[model samples]
Target: MTRMPFKKLALSTAAAGMIFGAALPASAAGYTDVPKESSHHDNIVRANELGIMTGYGDGTFKPNGQLSRGNVVKALGKYVVKHSGLTPEEYVKTYGTASVPNFSDVPNSWADQELVMYSKIVKDMGIFKGSNNRLMAGNLITRDQMAEVLARTFAFRDLPGAPEISDIGGSAYAKSIEILFENGISVANPYHPRATTSRAQLATFLVRSYDKVSKEESVMPASFYSELRKGKVSDAIVQIGSTLTELKKKAGDPEAEYDFEGGIRHVYGKYEYGVPHPVLEEGDPVTTVTYYFDEEPSLEEVMRHMGPVEQTEEEEDPMEYDYLWYHKGDFEVFFEYEWGGDTIDNVTVKSNR
Candidate 1:
């Protein structure tokens, strides 16, 4: 496994779209504290509307309040249920009530049944590990601890290696922290791990993680295009020869842009955003659409969605671009140079005829 290179891409500037469509109108479930101008207003509102989070009895969502470990766990429980295609009663029934108490602080009482159940689920999934049989449910969680919990909840442990973080190298949460960096959830700042995270910060993290998970799960398999392709590198939206303007209109704005020799390359993946058009040079359209990965995906993962490769070749040199090419009839996928060079960097679609 090679260490994946990090590329800085622009963030998407498009209007925040609904996660799974608005469960309820924001106006219908208004929170007094979260103003329309707040940075996390949309995320907090969406999470609340989806039943992942809730406001106080006074109809106030303390956007700047510190979230405790117990509260975080409860929120995650609701999140999983909403996205798991399972009803609340169904999940509780399937996982069963917590017969045995795992944490010293949270007892298996009728009043705490819901919390205990959620705690047990997270514990069984290895997302929340208590210390000395004590989860310190009421204790405020640090940023690093939050990273570990979120990473486990999303099952992001198999991420490709990331740059060394001096402070996190020896910690038990090192891998989880790395996954956070790899998935664009957090940055590698020295003091951030130990810092306390606010409700606003957690809201952003949840929304971003939700989008990432959704995108990965929603990717169309190559076989899906069997009838759509028509033996050409084209989808219902755009074809090989389609102009850059047409592509933008169909796919909305690209997340990132890269400058190439004759034209510009646009990326439509988890991270980055841009609206530049590709330069139209003579021979080919010169425009290339590349797909970036939040976590470096293996060749098998790519092939799973792209079908079998038609050809494979290596490009090794300093003068010329170094990359590995996997031809798939109508398009060629490129894996850029790294230590092992097995992770895909981008894909180029063109007319094979």
Candidate 2:
């Protein structure tokens, strides 16, 4: 349990959740040095233990790989099943057929079941459309596309109260963005709507949602739960009040794109937990020497093993994962980890997606 040379600050700040990639356990940072024979040898091993995501082919978890739209969709689907549990049939019945157009890329036989399932959800939510009414299943998905899909899937219909002057404008996604804002689903840049999203950002958003939807007894920290049981309103509020406040501010924006009749809808997704490291900035010591541990450490006692911590600068410009550490300059480091047969690693360099 090595402590950093820097001051030991209690992680009680309102923005701590944002820094940690949405309440991720400290073990997600993985040790800077790993043993070759360790059971959790690859990156994302800790994330896998937390049941957030999985890895890919070749027995390696490409944690730092760029997250594609398909990957994002699949991950979202996994979360839905874990948290919301919408069966394929149920998903299709609720939001598919009508919204998804027939496409040559996605034939009835190819990914037929998955296509129907996702299309129904996207369609019913009115967040996604086929490229020319065709589901481009084979194409790599982008960050912007996922943002819209996530916004719609979350059921953010309109901004809260009256739309501010700035909130009222933007492309078709403006309204949806507003709704996302109001619901704490996203906090968009005041200046742009087409800004890119990052894997870390997505992770944080999903984690928050997990907290919102999970049973209070399930996700709430035991200490906090004890307080709540004793009706310690102040203590319980302290644990989550700031997060709730941030979400409240986000609600200011309205969902202008599609106006669903009944508020926002809740979709299923998994909660990925891991410590996020910032990408280094230009002129910073190239050998500052941080570690990315890829092992399944005991979450209860892992924070002590992070070694003497030396926090870096706040990202000048927010990327998708700005809430975590920002990738400075162009070069980024993505420590790979394998989890659930998928890769989940934080990128420290330029945007991977």
Clashing pairs in 1: 10-272, 10-273, 255-272, 255-273
Candidate 2 lDDT, 9-88, residue by residue in tens: 11212212221122233344343333445433432343334455433333444333455454555555444332323355
Worst 10 residues of 1 by lDDT: 6-15
lDDT of 1 by residue, 157-231 (tens): 246556566687656667667777777766546636777778777877776665665454323333333222223
Regions more than 4 Å wrong, model 2? 1-50, 54-64, 83-104, 111-127, 138-144, 157-168, 188-192, 215-353
Candidate maximizing lDDT: 1
Question: Against the unseen true structure, what C-alpha lDDT does each candidate score?
Answer: 0.55, 0.35
Runs of candidate 1 with Cα error greater than 4 angstroms are 1-42, 45-59, 157-171, 188-191, 218-353
- lDDT, residue 201, model 2: 48
Task: lDDT for model 2, please.
Answer: 0.35
| Number of backbone-clashing residue pairs for each candidate, in the order shown | 4, 50
Cα lDDT for residue 349, model 1?
43
